[model samples]
Target: MPSDNVYPSSNGPSQVDDTIPIAQGQRTLFEFGSFDHSKIPLEPEEWPVIIIGSSMVGMTLGVLLGYHGIKSVSFDRHPSTAIHPRAALFLLRSVEIFRQLGLEDELRSESASNFDLDAGMIIVEKLVGGKVLASMQESDPAEVAKASPSRRLWLTQNMFEPLLRKRAKEFGAAQEFSETVVHYEELSDGVLVVVQNVQSKSYRKVKTKYLVSCDGNRSATRRKEGIEWQGPGVLGESISINFKADLTPYLGTRAKHGVTYISNPAIDAGFRLESGGKAGFMIVTRAGDKKSFSPDSVSERDAKRYFKEASGIEDDIDIKVDSISYWSVAAFNAERFMSANGRVFIAGDAAHVMPPTGGMGGNTGIQDVHNLAWKLAYVLREKASAALLRTYDAERRPVAGLLMRQAYSRLQKRVFRTVPDEPELPDIVCEIGYRYPSAAAAHIQNPNGDQYEDPHAPLVLPGSRLPHVLLSRDGSQISTLDLIKTNFVLLTTGQSSPWIEAAKGMTLEIDSYSINTDTGTVRDSEGTFSHICRISEGEAILVRPDGFIAWRGEWRKDGHRDELQKALERTLYLSGSKQL
Candidate 1:
């Protein structure tokens, strides 16, 4: 347990004065490398939401908020998207959110480069002529199809963050790189964020209705807010060498695969690497007590030597170092995800930390913002009450806690060999088991006491994702997920349930769609929706913008219109009779 003084006296590490701040108007790249500072504002940014990181999670928040016309700005101390091999794997849940922004196809194209290589992890005897120890499958296509239309993509943060950044900007969000949030405060009404240009050492104040801290594990915002994380801290440190080499000699026909793990007792450390196509491999191994891999300290020779020794290569291979990084593995969950008044919130590693073994650190963070973004948008747009915002923590913390433990457990299984190496949690369970319990969700039947239930179970009880079902929308085939938008969706059957009438008096963006109604209803070509979601003719399913089931109308309910209206009112926290 972290002591009370762990955070009571420290607001995280402060930016030590760079021996010298970049001189004003000087035309050289700053100490942190290069960033397009042209778009950075000289004046303070005033937006509805201020995100203090341009990480994948932060960018997703910006994109989601922008799509909803809720202006937001993101700032990062780093010059640009991760140059190092940080978080790479993205789950279908993250893909679904990107799909909403119309970037899913583009993302799929990027990951198509080495799909087979990404099939699973391979434990080898060595990088060169190594014996295969084990092969782990990340997901089973058949089981995955039953839960979600989207599947996990093997794309690194370096390759995909820019796509999100571009899409975010397209959706009207602004970004500032090399700008760090040094301080922040939640006032009676809004949050005031203080950001500084690392190069110029100049600061500006941003005042916004909300402040979302998507910064990493050592989050300054979280620390300043006195939000302490709970869980075993800092598992250990590792060296990640982003080096380019012709591994064709070693992997040969299997070069197209993404991940390769080498184990050799002769070598002091083993290699866990993911391929970066022509770019290179992001290799990780235990770091020395006093030495770490860094662009500044690691020379080409050093990187190649480290790679050769860890990979058990007898001869020095021709390798070029790109950018080396050292990172600590930790599993931590914040004491609380939100401040008392809810003016400030934390997401991503700022809220929780996870080991890289599960490839869920970044994916989980993306989902976090996706979950919070809409609720914040609705509250800001006046579609939902302020109380709805409280669900952000109530919903995400449980999942975060579970994922933290799971990631740590995976690391022990893979690295330390202290735990059973049976298999990681089933893909469906890790990706979709989490359910929200709050005013925003109304489980009308078979409510489970657990925060997360087995996703592989054949049920779409309220609060879970409306199971992916094939439906025909007009002439095109689409999944049940495609029907969900940035607002509430009331799904019913061919009878054109009363939900359509009930939404008439509502101010919310609630649209009614029936499975097989002749009056402009989407046809359930396969009857999958009815069978999987357990909905027959008279039943109704109300889905939130995030695609979680908000309410379920019992099959025999004679008058569901009023029930739906009341349920909507309760779920959305509407003060009056007005509802969807």
Candidate 2:
């Protein structure tokens, strides 16, 4: 139905400019054409991948693909990066993905604030001189460090997207704005897309081997593909008022509190501080019997009055209402993440939408593309079979379903103060401990095990993330997670020549590192590697490019090469048994 408005040549006179503006921060790494001044040639441009959105998720995918030497182009209807601070929290796993993409330091440096070790939620009748109702604490830093080398980030999406966009451009990924993907047709070999410029209404054709839609919840591509969402579509609605005010003086002893739930006769709202507690946003819900608030009806005066009531601040306090926005609190996951033909994939909010109570919406989307980008890179490079793409749906959709339930439950309890049937997993468990089924890893993973295990006492099982452990590589301290980035890793303990030999025989580049305290390859001086990972001498764990454990067992020289080869073949779908 979306393709019915195709702007074919017969639709109107051709006002084409024979040129298109260069994308923001774009660098000419791939020789796209012979046209002068880096302009379009008015012909169908073929790309390895064409992403339909250039927001956080789309830019992340582009950066990941470009890091793999895969060329991609991203198009978004917006003229630039996000203007509002959409998502404010990035979980540990999402931070880990950014770290893996070499953005950890930069992100932290640019973040408005980091969650303090003592950060938690405070409920009060008023911000100043009010009785506290309850206090809820987040996880401990020491506990989080045991599971991941990277910490959770509190940077807003508006600030974070530019970093990702710059990193993506550094890797030669192009990001075009003010362009919309009007229609697309999936072919046997690739996907043909019709892109229209917002200003000129001119159309251009792009042929990409794969099409990824990150176009938010109201995705045109998903609608065109006839993929429907399944879950509680809308739970509630509220208006978010983003403003600048130094509320630290009013917070007093609870200044370090990350979130403050304000409950009063005049207003019921939630306050989240940012910019080092100098700026923040308040989610204002309707007080009992109050009129339903709309963005159109709410003026700057109303926003300031709400802020003053929530903060219990004086009338003379300087509070600038920067923006007022409305949002639907919804929870849902798509019926499928991949198209019927498997050439088109949807990631981010397009595949799933959930409430932001737990800050998992954007993080889940970032991890979604982290799981898919490597598979796309491998398939596009012909290193893996097409069947590998099918695992994206099989693997991510279930995780999205679980996360949606978790988010909805959290919203119910936190915002509405009502308990739901969904059982709440621990924070670290929900963040990074969720495991995959054998459907993604083929026969190598446990299909019937629990979806998540205790991250503190990790099982180091297949389909789960490789547990993080502190190690010393050449006298420099590093995490076990630091070894995983671009290539598959074969990690073994003690002197394991057989694992190294097996890696050498593989056609794909697999880096083998033996953690030996004596030989000094990668020293596990504390034995935490053996204790946490549950691995001992002569045993090897095969880690996928995404840092999930694919296979782990004893590697004997008798048949080590054959065993590793079979594991890779089955896990990556190289055996040609499950081809689409």
Candidate 2 TM-score versus the reference: 0.89
lDDT of model number 1: 0.70
CA deviation > 4 Å runs, candidate 1: 1-45, 114-118, 267-279, 287-302, 420-424, 443-446, 517-519, 556-558, 577-580
For model 2, what is the error of residue 47's alpha carbon versus the real structure, in angstroms, after optimal superposition? 0.8
Off by over 4 Å in 2: 1-44, 112-118, 290-295, 445-448, 555-557, 576-580
List model 1 lDDT by residue over 50-76, tens digit each.
Answer: 888887888888988888779999988
TM-score of each: 0.86, 0.89
Worst 10 residues of 2 by lDDT: 12-21
Where does the lowest 10-residue lDDT sum fall in candidate 1? 13-22
Record all residue pairs in model 1 with backbone atoms less than 3 Å apart, i.e. clashing: 117-257, 117-258
- lDDT score, candidate 2, position 556: 68
CA displacement after TM-score superposition, residue 345 of candidate 2 (Å): 0.9
Q: How many backbone clashes does candidate 2 have?
A: 0
**Residue pairs with clashing backbones, model 2:** none
